[model samples]
Target: MALDDIRARIRAAEAAAGRPPGSVTLIAVSKLQPADRVEAALDQGQRVFGENYVQEAQRKWPAWRARWPEVALHMIGPLQSNKARAAVELFDAIHGVDRASLARRLARVAQETGLAPQVFVQVNTGAEPQKAGVLPAEADALIQECRQLGLNLAGCMCIPPDDADPRPHFQLLRETATRNGLSGLSMGMSADFETAIAEGATHVRVGSAIFGARPTERPG
Candidate 1:
């Protein structure tokens, strides 16, 4: 029932945006959530799931893969260069390839692993000093550089400022992708995903809407 509700909202958002239902990909963000919950979503025919931590995903992916080999996995959190090898080995697509150094490392790791992982260049649309993305002004050049590094530059991703209207950020990303000839935009999450879909979000990372509030992590 919960999955259906989420699906209905997705459909309505697509219709409201004048986009076909098939246009958007719903990336169920299962970060901090257990595999059983993911299996439930899978039972509803959802194939793409996004994970944050490399270690967490490493623990989850193999079991899930054994059960559902065709499922697509996306790395949707801040990725450190240290985790590049594991991330390249685990995720099918990575949504947070923000830095040029990280992109180079990921490309090298992918080359060694013989896995051409799809990637999104994250842009700090809000220019938040603490965020893990290239500043908005520098995004295009960085993306071009990533392309030159032999990384599969799929598109862009962004996290809007908490107090601002996310629509403008979404609009800017969509416009940038269009102007730059990029086709993927992995923007939007549970709170403002409807607005994102309205503004041309090719991929929406929704976690709580599907899996309930994320569980608090236990300190090891």
Candidate 2:
């Protein structure tokens, strides 16, 4: 019922934004949710999923890939360079390529695997030093560098300052993607997704709104 409600809300948001029906991608953040829960959502016709940890996803998704080939997994948390090969081979796209080093590793992995999952350069739009995204000032160069490395750079992603109006950050990410000729905007989350859609988000990473809450709670 919650997933249905969230999908209804997503459709409403998309329509209100003047986007075509189903223009937005809803990534059920299945980070701490168990495999059974994910399979239930799949039964309900939800296919796109997001995972925060590589190790956890690796443990869960391989079986599903054979059974539900249409399901897509997105890496929506900070990615480690050491896990580049696993990330490339496991995910359909990653929303957390935040630096040149990580991008380079992914590129190398792609060269070896003959596959490059789609990628989005995370931007620290709020300029928070502790975050994983590239600073807004550095986003362009980083995106360019990632693209040049032959990675399938899809667009841009951002996490707005928590408890603040996320519209500005959403707008910034939208603008950055437009300037770089990128098409995807992986912005917004459980709380601000509607505003994200209004600001041109093509993908929103929603967790609690659909899956209840994280088993180990953290600030969104």
Candidate 3:
């Protein structure tokens, strides 16, 4: 199955990059995938998953979590400040913390609930207006803000422009994380995970490759 194949590739990539095996975590992106498929991955011993929508996850994950209590779910999509508390309660890690407002909200929620998820500030390496990430130049300040707010900031994440080479973007994210004393690099998707691993990615979010493509119309 693709889950096993992806893990094997990760191990091989780690060896080629002279990194220790199990250094990188493969987040099986379960967003928009069917329950049966996600359960199949659980049966295959995949304990880490990534989701994009808070409501979708809220609707599905609690039931799934009851069965797979050890699963770690990551929020890998744009997070709204309005959903901060829910996100804090649901995710083990959040990879889309990109703004001050969202960070502040997350901080407040954490303070109220005493539950904070590991966070990765999303950096807009391409400076794409439509993208939901902090500008590359401002990522430092955002990281600092998150830290000051008492959020558990683990690292930096980026989604390179689809049309351009992702290696440079990956390198940029790695450098940002390194300068901030962060160790996690949550870049790379199915197409360029190997390159991301070479560039020091500690977590790679692979969806379609593992779960098959998401349905065109998500079920209500």
Candidate 4:
């Protein structure tokens, strides 16, 4: 039921955006999900998945790769500078690059690894104090700095405040990308992906809609 709903939403969003459904990449966020669930989704034709923690991703990705070599993994969490090497080594894309220093580190790691994983700048559109992203106003400068460091800036990403309408945030991100001459906007999620699509999001990270409710975290 959830998977069907997700497919329906994707279809509707693409139609509303006047884009071919294939143009928007649906990244199934499988941060807390186990490999079996990921394999099931793979069987259902989901080729892209996102993980949050580097350690968790490092543990889960290899098994998934062993079973399905074509699966693409994206890192969609706050990446620490110390974790840059492992992140560059493991994931196919990094979506939480918010600072120039981190971008430089990632670029260096990518260069050393000889694998240029796609990179996205995460912007704190809502300016939440606890979030891990650059303030929206600083995004352009960060992008330029990243380009100077040889990081392939594919697009921008944002997570709007939970209660606010996400359309404005999505619109802002789209405008930011356009102003900077970038093409990708990796905004939106299960709740607000339609708004993101309408506002020109090229990628949407969906979790519960595709993977069911996330499993409860065990006490650390």
Top candidate (TM-score): 3
- Model 3 regions lying over 4 Å from their true place: 218-220
Candidate 3, after superposition: displacement of residue 7 in Å? 0.5
- Residue range 79-192, candidate 3, lDDT tens digits: 989998999999999999999999999999999999989999999999999999999999999999999999999999999999999999999999999999999999989999
List candidate 1 segments past 4 Å from native.
Answer: 218-220
Indicate whether candidate 3 or candidate 4 has the larger TM-score.
Answer: 3
Using Cα atoms with residue i matched to residue i, what is each candidate's TM-score against the true structure? 0.95, 0.96, 0.98, 0.95
lDDT of each: 0.87, 0.91, 0.94, 0.88
lDDT of 2 by residue, 90-152 (tens): 999999999999999999999999997999999999999888899999999999999889999
Please report, as a residue range, the 10-residue window in candidate 2 with the lowest summed lDDT: 211-220
Across 60-94, the per-residue lDDT of candidate 4 in tens digits comes to: 77876887889989999999999999998888899
**Which sections of candidate 2 miss by over 4 Å?**
217-220
Q: Which pairs clash (backbone N, Cα, C closer than 3 Å) in model 1?
A: none
Q: List clash counts for every candidate, in order.
A: 0, 0, 0, 0
Worst 10 residues of 1 by lDDT: 211-220
lDDT score, candidate 4, position 82: 100
Candidate 4 off by > 4 Å: 218-220
**RMSD to the hidden true structure, all candidates:** 1.4, 2.2, 1.0, 1.4
